[model samples]
Target: MKKVLFSAALFFTACAVSAQESVVKEAKSAKSDPVKAAQIIEPALTDPSTANDPETWKLAGDFQKSIYDDENMKLYLPGGQADTAKLYNSLAKMFEYYTKCDEVEQAKVQSGELKKPKLRKKLAKTLATVRPQLTNAGSDAYNAGNYANALKFFGLYVDAPQNPLFADEDAVKNDTLTPLIANYAALAANSLKDNAAVIKYATIGKEHKEEGYRSLMCLAEAYGKGETPDSAKWLTTIQEGVEKFPSQEYFIGNLMDYYIQKGKIDEGLAQMDAVLAKNSTPYFMYVKGVLQYEKKDYEGAIATFNQIIAEGKDFVAEAYSKIGDCSFFPAQEIVEENSKLSMDDPKYATNEAKIKELYEKALPFYEKAKEAKPDNRQLWGQYLLNIYWKLDKEKYNALEKELGY
Candidate 1:
């Protein structure tokens, strides 16, 4: 009877041990299965972020990574919630683990989800909703010295209807986003060297009062910068803008530049004269002087620049430098070239008188400018160089002795 009891006990122990081993194997298998592992690890995601329910929590973590990355991320990270400060913090930590700064991290900060679909429809849609703000942000970016970011925002402003930020913009019956957007669009286009875009945006800007003037600037800058070869087109745009906003000095100045570049010297001069007639800002006069210098009207340029210097408060050393440039480039020599005698001959004495007269006209302006701008190396050098070359031997020798130069 005792031996029978022992056998029964052995059978019971072996059965128990076998059941325990089977349980352990099953647990290992469950842990190895990713889907099951995820479910077992964080079932809250599977039950909540999915599509079957109004609450988007069910598929929150179950998107097919290869196929639905964008979709999943969008679902989890919806637009308004995408780039929150808290969400960004979380994303930053995850990226720090890998020592990388992938756009995915930014998107995660943007969308607030790891399971976001690769296509990112939600973010795009959200972006469309904030179109106006984004456009404004683009302008701000340019103001803040971020050209690339400015271009991006301006692009969104133009294409706002298709973007996620579209709803945030303002549209009117008589005046819509088309014009305002085009203004910013021109600025962006100029920065990016997109000539077509500049034309499109500047046209829109011209529809508005303040922004229109700015748009004209974009047109002028684009042509001046040589990013676009369509100078004629830019000029035409400037003329139209000038006609519409006639009193705007900024637009007039740009128009002057356009005419000069187009080689319409008389028209450019007329424009400058009109501008100067109104109130000769040093800059306008300086530009006029430069135009004269380039056109080989050295005497005319010198006279205009002198008017600026005499005005005292309107101009800077640039005017002085430019005047020196014109005189130093042999304006007197050129007149001598047309004379009837060699410089060393008796007839040349007549030529020398003309040279001295021209030199006298330029000397005091440079000398006075140099004195006023003691720290300006360019002005000082110009004065010294001119003095040494233009004055007679006795006068030059005396001045050099005085200056100890």
Candidate 2:
């Protein structure tokens, strides 16, 4: 009875080994038919006898790559139409399988199951060759408004340089498109409202030259959002953005808006004062003037703007316009005060004269603003119309005709 039981155990063990070898051989023979080969070998991945074999995972990777290639090749055929969705799906699967194969091989090497990696070079070469396609796939999905998939593909491409498959490749290290792809991934994350992902990618994206400003803007926006917004980080990010890109108004404007929204004008002015102490640029002076204006310290604003004008920088026109606003807003307040009194009131005429005096003060500055930026209607057009109407009707009518009003 003992001998018979031992024979049965031997038969079962032999059958398991035979099943593993038989499936492997049959899968290899059907390699030309990628679909059939994949179907035949699918079970081997989880089969107790073959699950630990690196060769099984490698075969699976090859089948997936073959499926991707077969579908992609249809694009060159005369009447063959390729399904892009299927192509990208297979391509992603190919990458996954290849990554898994590499992991399994490494694990085997570590476990003393193999002397060295035999497939590393081949796998690395294959991954390098196909890496750029991930960018193309991401861009296509982005243009199609598939933000989630676009982020996925772009993330894969962005991370490929650091991937183990490209550990020895210098070309991957110097790839210039990584930063740009990171920008795209950040844009996708922004579209998806994934603030964490936006910060993640935008931090990397902001290192790119041509598109770096946009990434910086996105980073600031992400830092300023969410349930518990980091106001300090948001301000710091905007300040850094302004320092790096002084010509970009978005960063400066956001910085100023934050001060206004949080009623921290004094804090903003102190910081600006500190900045100006080191190197006073006309642009920084203009920001200071605008902050003062928002704080309703019109005299201080006018003084700051006058300093900008004295510097004879490109901000001269903006300085003149802001000065006009200082006088104009005061005149408007006088007009409101006069409206509250009766025409026979003693202070009415006095207030009226003061209003005219302020309008007269504003006239020259508005004229200068118009001369500096003739095409910029926002700077001077409407303000000049009001000033001229109050003080000179004929000039107002003529200017109105010229503006096609």
Candidate 3:
């Protein structure tokens, strides 16, 4: 019985070695026949006899890398259309196999089962050459609306710099594409509604030059809507965005909307006041005025708009329109209220005169706004129409005709 068992053990050992050698031979054919090579090497990865062997994993990695190279080469051929799914999949598999190989090899080195590192330098060099392709894969996936795959590829690219295989590579450290790719990753995460992922990538991306503003916006949205929302972080991020990207309205609009929704318009005004005190831009002052208007502080809004007008900046026309709005909206409220009152009410005539007086007060400001920016119908057109209809029918008819109304 003991002799029979020994013979059986020897036979299995021979079979294992033969299988390992066969897989390696198949891997060599990967350059010309990668699909068949994959069929053989893929199963060898999990087979009990070859699973722990670093050589098997290395062959697998090399096979996938060869497949990627061949597929990428086809892109330069005449009328060659890339199979993006195949290309991305092969790249991802190459990374995975190489990572597994490295892990196994390192373990063997530590265990003294291997005399020295065999594939580490070759793996590092190959990965350094292949790392940048991750960005292209991510972009293709993103444009194709494959958010999950896009995030995967982008995340791998972002992580490649710190990966052990690229430890000696300066190219990863100096790559200018990192920040842009980070922003794209955040955008992909946002499309997937993966708030945590958005925050993760956007935090890194917010320093990019061209896409930083967009990343900052993504960061704020993630903070506001994450599983356990952090309102303070959301507010701070939006404030930072407003300061960094003053020309973009997204941050400021969302900030104001948050305050309005929370019924904290006064708080919003206070914050804008603090910003204005520090940097006193016409844009921030306009935001403050709008917040004051939302709070129904008409007098405060008019004063803020007047200050913006005094500054004589690009906001002058908007300031004039806002000043007109303050009076015009109040007059509209009076009209609504007067309609509810009985015609015989003694206050009815007084309310009608007050409405007309407010309209008269608004007319000059709207006219000034129109004069300042004749092409900006949004600033003054409807307001002027309302004022003329109430205070002067002849001008109202003429203006209506000119407007094609």
Per-prediction CA RMSD (Å): 14.5, 6.3, 5.1
Once model 1 is optimally superposed onto the true structure by TM-score, how far is the C-alpha of residue 313 displaced, in angstroms? 1.8
Task: Show model 2 residue runs off by greater than 4 Å.
Answer: 1-29, 36-52, 71-84, 260-289, 295-324, 331-405
After superposition, candidate 3 runs with Cα above 4 Å error: 1-31, 71-88, 107-117, 144-146, 173-177, 226-228, 243-247, 260-282, 295-300, 303-321, 332-342, 363-405
For model 1, the run of ten residues with the poorest summed lDDT:
58-67
Please rank every candidate by lDDT, starting with the best. 3, 2, 1
Candidate lDDT (C-alpha), each: 0.57, 0.85, 0.86
Order of candidate numbers by TM-score, starting with the best: 3, 2, 1
Q: Estimate the overall C-alpha local distance difference test score of candidate 2.
A: 0.85
Q: Each model's TM-score, in the order given?
A: 0.53, 0.69, 0.75
Cα lDDT tens digits, model 1, 1-405, are 999999999988777655544433343355434234333423322222221221222122221111122322553764523332222222222222111212333455456565543323433333333334555556666787776666655654555443332233334123266567667778777877776677666766777765677788787667656644576766776776666666666666677666677788777887777667866577878878878887889889989887887787756566776777676556446564747566677756766676666676667666666667756756656455655666756756755666557
Per-residue lDDT of model 3, residues 295-361, tens digit only: 8888989999999998898699999999999999999999999989998998998998999999999
Tens digits of per-residue lDDT for model 2, 1-405: 999999999999989978987898899999999879988988888776786777887888798788878888898899989877877876776777777778888888999989898887788788778788888789899999999999998988887777786787777777899998999999999899899888888988888877877778888778888667888888888998877776676886787777888999998888678667865788888999999998999989999999988878778999999999998988998999998999999899999899889999999998998898878878888888988898999999998998999
